[model samples]
Target chain A: MTSAPELVAIVPAGGAGTRLWPLSRRSRPKFLLDLLGTGRTLLQDTADRLAPLTGPDGLLVVTGTAHAAAVADQLPQLAGDGAANLLTEPSPRDSMAAIGLAAAVVEHRHGPTVVGSFAADHVVPEPGGFHDAVRTAVEAARAGYVTTIGIAATGPSTAFGYVRRGAPLEGVPGAYAVASFVEKPDEDTARGYLATGEYSWNAGMFVARTDVLLGHLTRHQPTLEAGLREIAAAWDTPAREEVLARVWPGLTKIAIDHAIAEPVAAEGGVAVVPGAFSWDDVGDWDALGGLLPADEAGAHTLAAATSAGDNGAARPTTAGPLLAIDSPDAVIASDGGAVAVLGLPGVVVVRTGDAVLVVHRDHAQRVKAVVDALAAGGRPDLL
Target chain B: MTSAPELVAIVPAGGAGTRLWPLSRRSRPKFLLDLLGTGRTLLQDTADRLAPLTGPDGLLVVTGTAHAAAVADQLPQLAGDGAANLLTEPSPRDSMAAIGLAAAVVEHRHGPTVVGSFAADHVVPEPGGFHDAVRTAVEAARAGYVTTIGIAATGPSTAFGYVRRGAPLEGVPGAYAVASFVEKPDEDTARGYLATGEYSWNAGMFVARTDVLLGHLTRHQPTLEAGLREIAAAWDTPAREEVLARVWPGLTKIAIDHAIAEPVAAEGGVAVVPGAFSWDDVGDWDALGGLLPADEAGAHTLAAATSAGDNGAARPTTAGPLLAIDSPDAVIASDGGAVAVLGLPGVVVVRTGDAVLVVHRDHAQRVKAVVDALAAGGRPDLL
Candidate 1:
């Protein structure tokens, strides 16, 4: 093996999966749920997918301090059977901070000829195809352009933002120049864009050389630029906490796409690799069925009663203590106690030891209301 | 006050409440659920409801051996704190055997003239109505006729059997001759019968001299007749188990309505007090809400969850440790480990330490299927 290209993997494992509730609690988020009961969690699966590409020592994960222990425990392949460079944030400041921090660490350690920012909570079924896209993007990143792995739009998914591809960049034949970044669009507009075949779901996976990413950030978001340099100077250096505390909260809470990637494209720089390896952010409850081997009629246990009426069985004559019963297309999770839903569709039920929650799944995007109410009521203990 | 009519309240606290599963188990049946948390179980509530009518010495309860302890625990008003004359069945025999045993004991101890049979699990909202009906039925029974309290039919309820009224019997003028008995009819036929205004719900509550009931049993169900006499011969006498074992299972599983009430009505001899009081067998989960305090949308709980829409101020939240968000018309009950029901309607979710059950209120009739499955799976340890 005569010197294969140096690979660096930046794993962003942060979001508190509130939409997947009950099972995905504040303490243990969705990446930890045994949705498939395959004895591996989502974050572990993501790490396994990237293991062959980066090898053990080259992978670094950035997460909040609250989840550091859990993230370390899940990624067992790390050096000394411990998490390799488990970067902990002082607080949740969103993806821009996480990616920038990861970039700084990778540049300092590996000289970042090519770095892959992979979401630890994503589900990529065809690992081979995902590897191919990562390989192609690595070639493009070597030519000094920031590359994002654009998932071929499967349907008009209004839940995710979209990226419109422009003409192919020079020297990278199959990759297209990024034209514009679209915020989550309405259903009809999403459908229209899907029909045109020039748009893809923003899978949040990005590839770039150290110089290209830092250059893009410096031009578009100077506030993040200063913070990234400060955090980088203190990397494995003392005063790390003091530096992070000064700059992390001061930066605007925005995704890297909005702050840096999209602006780089507008300034005629960013590129896209349209690949068909089947990817998902694993963002919500509805996304689980596609990622795992579900029972016929498509149901999985998130600690809820799963009755398959599609099997033509009479009233789901299954044997077991069913924690809760729900209508078709509903997601119910219980702690063997607090949350039980009956005749509900498109809803999520979550039960913690002290608090139980029931929310309409469609309105699941509004679950922050529950947290806000609890917090406003001076019950920080519940939050 | 003039001596109250001699009232003997023979409460039948038998039969497993399988329809209210998880919450209502073999160890803790529906009568034990603190549905209203009114400092009483259903058995306790039933006894309390009859407190004014039956003096301390007049209340007799009949339950199986397995549940005698539970029954005793619930009602403190019965003899020996409601345990005296608590006739436990030789085994898991049906209601007819339990009723016969009660009749034998009542006649042997309190004479044949005035005894009333009431079901242990029901919610009669108007105690005054129940009191009036009980008094009237007692007067009518003393006049040498069997008197069953009949609820005025509210609608065409296909769920319950109906009793047809005939001519008024002599001396008990408010009581009518029971012209006939009808099984649960088809919806259309039930509607036709209801329109005629000549039928009432056969609630299985009856007031009759013990001798009169025994006579009717002898004329109709001779197996019940033989069993009753054997039970009577061994009454308060020794060698209880030996005699009960020989006679109990031989008694048919026929209900009192089919064995005695129907036969007497066929002969145009029985009468019913036009009972203005309401009654429910409390037969299934759908029937439970009527007996409990329900909100405007008719939701109740051992534990329940309701939803708050975009305008959070519109939803009234729970007052305890549990939190419910944006759920409506669902019944949730928990001992404390957090039960949350999301978007659901007319359903029951119950959680106990060992088991959890979920079912639609309408399909609650099939909860016994789940129980049977649990039992058949050779987990009587759980059942």
Candidate 2:
């Protein structure tokens, strides 16, 4: 078999947010949590999946300073000399800054290689399909097209934005030109997109040569691109911290979707590689409950991390036994005590040391309102 | 106002069964708990409501050995010389033994005084109506009847047993001979009972002369009565522990309703004083949620006990904040963390030191299934 192309996987380890309150807090973001009750955390799982594609030294993680140490701890590959690739942002400047800085730094070290940006917190169950999608995207990247892996639409989900496919890329196999990028649509609009069979979910998995991404940024957002380049130049030098402090704070805070993806697609410079793989952002408790495995009783439990020395244990925040009764599809996690759910199907009960959250699956998104109430009620410590 | 007679309130501090698990454990029975957000525990509240009628040093308490210390701690009246009136059972022998033992002891100390057995765990928000019922019951008791306060049926609550009223008692006003005492009925039967105005809920508040209660016990359950009397004879003496060790375990584990109320009603020896006051057994979370006062948002929050030094606060078992959102009439409680309820109206989320319970009020009585599940799953410790 032929070897995979030279590509760096940039994982922006942020945004497991308020929608996953109590479990995913400001102190413990979603990427750092073992939300899937699997052997590894979301960040670790992302690293493991991308490791084969990027090779040992090609994986670079960019996370907030608050989560930097935790990222390093979870990823032993980042120990010693490998620590150089683990980038820590001084403060949050949105996704554009996080992904852009990592891309710029990779270019500074390895000169214009293919790098794909993947969120550290997203869930991609089977690595086989993901690897295939990434390889195709990387080939399109080598052909000088900014390629994004458009996840095959499982359903007309109104939660995610849709990317419409146009003509097949002339040079690259399994790659198509993007017609347009649309924001989250209403049910009717999303259903229409599905019927056309030309639409896929924009999962934000963009693969491109460092030069092409920076060149697009230069044309779209020149000032933001320059600051990222400055930060990357001094990233490995003794002036790293000082450069970040001065340049990072002033970087224009915008999502890469706004600064690059939408604009590049408009110019016919962006390509879509349809990813026929299960991918989820795990946006809210409802989405998360759907991702978790159900027991014989049909109860879905979010157990503790494998780091605790037990594969499927209690919550990482607290340790105890979990039990669900008459509560089918119950998403139960407790901070430090036993949890038992009863007589409620599709119940989501997450109890942390600081707070307990109870919501039904249908009302999962409404958990944001609860977090807002707590903040407005002057209990931000709970958030 | 006519002075309340020489009546002694025998508070049977027992029976908050598995339905109220976690909050009411074997070590901490329901009677010892402040299920209400009110500062005083059910036991303390029972004593407070009865103190005026019982007079100084006239109130007596009978509780299981495990909860004796907690009972004494909550009721300061049980301290010093008053400790004599606080009776402890070496082991639980059900309601009949508990009430009988207290009556025998009360008669031994105070010469067959009119004694009323009020459960420590029941809720009586208004003392006026409760006291009026007891006074009328006391008159019936003095006239040689085993009188139980019949609560005016608020609804067709199939959870409670019903007492059918007969002809009015000859000498006692507002008191009638019990036509029959029925067990918990089906919804159809309960509705039928409610249609007849003569039917009232059997609140289990039995008021009677100690001799009358003992006489019924002697006629029906002689062996159990004799054992209780023997235990009572040695109760306040040095041989108290020795006699309890011998007789307590052998006594019949039967409810007072079966031993006396049911049989005595057959012989026309049972009287029921109509008590038109709100009384709740606090049978399950549904009943509890109903008994608790609602806030402006219509959420009935069961806060920490007043003993916590904060009037309306978190769960008594925990120390933290509580928040309820779009979930109207949500009953949220936590053992030791802040609790938030979202979008589930009439939801009951109870997190305890050992386990968490989530159910809707519509399925509140079904919480017993959760407890049973825990027990079957080898988590009896949670129960």
Candidate 3:
């Protein structure tokens, strides 16, 4: 656990999560929400999972200015290390800048150490399997290979990208060279990938030496790297606000997958650590229903949205009462009021304080249409 | 129009409307609710329909003691005439006792006036045709026949009883001799009845000379008629409560159709006055949905339950807010909370203050199962 002297874990928290709208709002994003009805929010859960691997002062959280306070509020340990441990982007330039800023800042404060980027809103149910693969990924990262912990696929799910693994690295025992990173495939293509048994779900989890990441960024996204480096130079000082105000707005807006993982894997500089932990990005209500236990009616009910384990106070906003009859496989949620469902199997009901959403599980991905409709319908408060 | 010297209108208000549970409680029966989202409660609407025919002093409402205050509160014109106008039975003894008592009371007060008994919960839209039919029915009643207004059938509905006309009465124009009074028919039988062009929906709208109706009751249900006469004799006096308490529960519990109409029609003492008014019993959520206009999503949304037409102040109970998406033909009602439906066609959702129900339209009649389960499951408050 204490093998790497300067392996800092970085968390990139963002996204409006529009598909999970009415529950996931702009002011209260998904990362700060207990979507699974679990006692800990996704960010807090992410912090707990990495705390053992990163140690007390070795974890960093980079979020937008809007959610910075909430991110720190959920994970108070990030606050103890001062401004250096919690990086706030003035205006979101997407994942490339968010992660590069943290990597550059970590290198400035503690030299070019191996740093890992994990999303603040992913679900890794058990810590043991996650910890094991992360340890191997950290070893590969220390060995100067850009590494990622690829989740072992449970099905031919087309919602997430896939990573192909090749021959094992000479020095790193379990880490294999990542052959390529592919886009979200069609269902049949995903089936073919699964049949090959050489592909894992690309969970956007990347671990690499700070020097190696900065080196790849210099060769690929050079302008984005320079702006992040400028902000990192003044990050621990009073000049941080001034430099961030000047450089943050102009950083290249690209995901870490497109900027680093995909191209770096093609260049033989990336390694894949196969992770056997049960994982889900929780892309929609259908996915969320799959994660929850079914009740007597075979419907998944959302309990009071209280995070009991994270030392957070019980919120007044709750999932309220639900009476479901003959509605097998339906997901019913309410905001401090009673809801009833009958005969509508696989229906998704999301009743919040201001807006309510109802969609079939088969059309869960199309909830974005309702969000878009609300926006066009002069209901910005709902969005 | 006012040829008959004495024409009294009697309204029998009862029935918990178990199919519309939570909305129609023991305390707030279906007759007291403005279910169609219109400004008039069913009882108030019935009073208004009969008011023009009965005049100020000619209308009497026969309800149970439990609903006396609400009945008087809803129809203040009845309050103007004191306890005589608002007759409260000690207990429910079905339709025969309620109507027979009203008829007996009319004979005692007005000496065998033609009294018409109309149920408190049937919807007769456009009262022009209804008033015309009642006027003709009163004429037939004055001619010594136990006259009933038979509504023209809109479809082969199997929910209501049917009456077949034999031939036009020799004395009373537009009145026909009833050949038979049939119970609710099966779909094929109802379709056959509709094809005959002589069958009409038996809407429980009976108009008869109080003496003639009493005579029919004496022949068919003598004990019930004697008990009703005894109570009616003391109805306006201070001993009304005592007489009701003694005789009401002991009277035979039977529907008016079984007690007098069926047997009397078989004996050629009954006559049918054809009614062309649009009519509905609104027997269940599906029927109620048919009565309400569809919104953009083709769902019938229940509005605030305010009887604006009546002088009574609006009760706090309301159907609340609803956001429906892709839920065509859904019946969604709420008691002051937001409800949303998505992707379900013909679904019925009733969310009240204490309970909620969700059932598809095809299963509307089966809602009694949920009410039964709630009773069996120790949720009597919901029932």
Off by over 4 Å in 1: A1-5, A79-84, A238-254, A290-298, A302-383, B1-5, B79-82, B219-227, B296-298, B304-328, B354-359, B372-383
Give lDDT per model, in order: 0.69, 0.82, 0.82
Return the candidate ranking by TM-score, descending.
2, 3, 1
Best by TM-score: 2
lDDT: the better of candidates 1 and 3: 3
**TM-score of chain B for predicted candidate 3:** 0.94
Cα lDDT of candidate 3 equals: 0.82
Q: Interface RMSD value for candidate 3, one decimal?
A: 3.4
Model 1 Cα shift for residue B80 (angstroms): 2.3
Docking class of 2: medium
In angstroms, give how far residue B34 of model 3 lies from its true place: 3.2
Ten-residue region with minimum lDDT total, candidate 3 chain B: B306-315
lDDT of 2 by residue, B1-383 (tens): 12233998888887646777667676667776678866577777788888878877778888877777777777767664648778887777888998899889878776777988888888888889988888888889999999989888888988889999999999788999999999999999999998888899888889989898998899899999899889888887889889988888999999999999999999999999888888888888888888877876777776544232233122245446667777788886655668888888898877665566778888877777777777787866676
Docking class of 1: acceptable
- What are the candidates' individual DockQ scores? 0.33, 0.70, 0.36
List the per-model TM-score of the A chain: 0.82, 0.93, 0.94
The order of the candidates by DockQ, greatest first, is 2, 3, 1
lDDT of 1 by residue, B282-379 (tens): 67766775566665444666542112123211123343433344444566666655554545565565555555556667676776766776676566
**Candidate 2: segments with Cα more than 4 A from true spot:** A1-5, A80-82, A306-321, B1-5, B80-82, B305-319
